[model samples]
Target chain A: MTDGTPILHMKDVRFQWPGRASFSLEVPSFEAGRGEKVLLLGESGSGKSTLLSLICGTIAADAGDVTIDGTRLSDLSGGARDQFRAETIGVIFQQFNLLPFGSVVDNILLPLRFAPERRARVSDARAEAAALSLALGLPDVQTAKAATLSVGQQQRVAVARALIGRPPLIIADEPTSALDANSQAAFLDLLFDQVRAHDTTLLIVSHDARLGERFDRVVQMADIARTTERAA
Target chain B: MMLRLAFGSLRARALTVTMTVLAIALSVALFLGVEKVRTGAKASFADTISGTDLIVGARSGSVQLLLYSVFRIGNATNNVTWQSYQDIAARPEVDWIVPISLGDSHRQFRVMGTTPAFFDRYKYRRDRGLELGDGAIMNDLFDAVIGSDVAATLGYAVDDPIVVAHGLASFTEHKDQPFRISGILKKTGTPVDRTVIVSMEAIEAIHVDWQNGAQIPGQSTPVEVIRQMDLTPKAVTAALVGVESPLQTFALQRAINTYPEEPLLAVLPGVALQELWGIVGIAETALLGVSAMVVVTALLGLMATIFSSLNERRREMAIFRAMGARPRTIMALLVLEAVLTSAAGAILGVAFLYLGLMIAQPMIDSAYGLWLPIDAPSTREALVLLGVVAAGAIVSMVPALRAYRLSVADGMMVRT
Candidate 1:
């Protein structure tokens, strides 16, 4: 994964906390092509969140290599990891995450403030913000204080923020969980379509299988021992 | 950009910032008020004596002597014999001498008895020479030239007949022989403002019937009757003298101390003022210390307010961190936020201080007869406010550190 070969490649990756008696995650090898929409499906306690953390470089894996965009996640220093994660990936949490006090535009502009490289590439950030807001169907007043919006609107703003300045990868963790069924289908359509339009790969994690058909590929996480016993 | 966020957050938490600003403002007001009065008191003291190299009076402490003679703060000790004043004033080193006889007041303001030469040579400060506001200078035996405060308080203009009490102590009213107000002085913001100036002969003529400090029992001497007696003072409270050279002060003092007629003390006005300051310095220090503690309390209150609001700021901090803000960046955000708020509070405090002084100046000058000048913060006070700003910034870190810890946990979405 540390080598400059694949856009994303994982090899024999295992992660466990220091005090834990068991490994929380294990993957011998995994690869995803550029511009791929991959759904990482998991039930409760399947370590989907743990794997997401590993991918984002928020938590270093215990063993093996996990690389994104040909840069090994483990190779990044603490500060560099933060910079790289912001520059390379747009992460969406289950809950719409926004700085409560800041205006919607300021929250969107947050990533570039951390990674100056992203700021340098975007010449017209204000225009991009307007386009991005308009694309999210965010009305002028809805973007004033993010807390003032409905859950669905907030989720869209979060998605807009994730795609703002157009990073290479989008990682969403149950980003549409709080939406109504109709809103969820509409949101998923807009989200995936935007990801395709921007040419960014998306690794979305969700427990619900009903949303699986929307992705190009669906990945099911297995119980390590049960799968091993079945393989034997 | 971070400034915008901090300011926005502060606005969101408007109640906390406003309370902090108000607390700091009151502290500044209190500090400026105390300092103004102290400075004004010192200035008034400085203006009370001028051109007089030394003031000789009956043997006593320097401050008490200065009090009765110059500031009219208290009654003088036993008056120096007239012959003793004469002996000292006759010296070759003495350029001019103004004899002063005290122990009288009207409405608690001192009435001083001196010769015409007292007004002619009496200079409270060298640069601020005597100038009359209206009417001629003292010419008649019982003519009275009033100080600015006395004129304002009693509404006495020139040629107005005003009586003098018998003693320097409060509650005495002498209705027997009232001297006319012959002249009034310009406001000097000094103790002279509260004084009534009359000739030593007027003092002698007015008290002629009162032998050995007692009026003959039931014997009434009318005002017209007093001017008929010999107007020569037996004893004078003090004498103000200008020296040929300041270097001869100690020699002059020794000469006055060893006078053959009576035991006397000569105090250099400058050294006496220093001594008087030493006498009152402890009270001033206590006041300054109290004001300083108020400032410290206000700053701590500000820190405590910010600390309380930090819990609400955790999620905001996590959002910044998740946006690729580094650990130091988060810390910088809080630090910068603290500094700006503290600086803002301090600036508001100074503005509040200026406004308070402006409001209090007239009231203090008229009501308490104390001049509160509008001036820049003293160096010590400036340093205290700066310390408040610094302490405020440091105080902000307490909340920021809490945020930092939350952000660390928030790294893996583990933060609550």
Candidate 2:
């Protein structure tokens, strides 16, 4: 009962793969309220990616209840989980996460095409995409072909894709790793602008602590314990 | 949209897709081609005579009798006595008899001598009754009616008087008994189309001056003068019987076997056709087996093509996943690409078969003596094609599952 309305909430979460030794990720309780910009930092095998999978309803935590937008993620069936992710959540990943053949704009509007409800919510989806492109400093044509662009351009397109439908939650997994420092800063700046413009809750996963100060809250994967000792 | 996307990617891999299509198309062509020919041959054999109950020929295997007398493939070793035919025709169980006299040819076309009743009850095809195409039946003892192919090939028209060059001779014999061509038959797509039909007297007229396969040396008689003498045939090659009932076939066969004058072997046309087919079934089955192997290999070609492209498509899959396409969406795309490719191959295979038939039709008819009706796929054929395309789609799924794993492993980025 920590907040009036938490955009994402995890309670006594425990996740384990089949036949694994122990739970891969454990957290007694954690929550992010609406419009909060949170940063999750971890080493390579610190279960940060696993946590993201849990959050997006890709995989269910073995022994915990997780909620996004007040809907329990684990309770959703296969189809419902897909619909939930497609309509209500957008994810941004590092590196070459794009259909190489599809045009950049097509990539950005992928979620809308999958979930009809999402398409309906964003009336004039292309218009929404166009507006979001302008907000992220990406020209409409930059969404032409994703593979043709530099890493920086691809990251910006990814940002446009994540924020296009005005989804309530946006997750990014070190989306700026490929960019130079200046390009990284610029990409981060474009990302924050769109997130704030749409009032979307942002959770960016990164190992680079130097980028930590920009986020509203920071949670390290080592802090995923079943007690409140690291909550402060 | 997914189908369009898959098709677009396939189009992008134009060469690979084209090769896959060609592989499948060639296999399908072979498969359908062999199946069609085998089926057509069986149909022709069974349908050659619709109304005949029994075939009475010289003592030989039922299949041999059928081949020589009906199909005109081999020559008969013996001839049945005309007295046996007359006695059998007089039997109460026998309704009508159409005597078929063989052993003569014009340009590889066999000549058949039969009574005028052949035009009445001797139906070759059940669907089309026997009706003469031209002038009246052969009451003119020296007249002849030509098969469609004979008339067309030799350019014989009605009322054309031509000599019967006796006894299967291609160049010269029986020059004196030149008979007139009185009528021409329409194409029946059967052995009838390749035969010269004449009265039994005409067959006798040419043989009157001959004995033991040759005209008496320097002993020739004019055909017009032979009309002054006896016109009844001394003997015949075989006889086509239509009995009161199909049940009489066994009894009549026994009667012909026990004929007092001579031993005449009799057979049911349908039974003989079946017996002949069984003999050729091995060759047909072997053909089908090889074509099926071709089909399997073509499908494997599809699989290999997709599998080879799987590594390249890793990046493609990751990119699509990054685009918010789920695993199922990627699967749909891969399946669509394979199915569409296979469908194109099937269509191309059919087209190839058609074009091949059109180009080689005449050669096939003359060389193989086969006619493959170049028509649309029957329902069974359509279903077969659908199965092939679906199987292609399923085969592509093996790659789709790989893509699924790649999308998950790649998450948002393909490392390489």
> In model 1, how large is the Cα lDDT of residue B245?
85
Chain A TM per prediction = 0.90, 0.91
CAPRI classification of candidate 1: medium
Single out the weakest 10-residue window by summed lDDT for candidate 1 chain B.
B407-416
Lowest lDDT sum, 10 consecutive residues, model 1 chain A, at A223-232
Interface C-alpha root-mean-square deviation of candidate 1: 1.6
Per-residue lDDT tens digits for candidate 1, residues B1-416, read 78898787777778878888788778866776677678776776666678788899998888889888887877776998877777887898888888998888777688888877776676765567667888877788878888877888878877778877787564545667767888898876667778888888888877776766667778778767776777778889998988888788778888987877777888988889888988777787789789978877887787687677666666666566667777677877877766777778778878887887788777677555567678777797788678777887787777767767666655646544
Q: lDDT: which candidate is best?
A: 2
Candidate 1 shows a clash count of 3
Could you say which candidate leads in TM-score?
A: 1
**Candidate 1 residue-wise lDDT at B359:** 84
**Candidate 2 CAPRI level:** acceptable
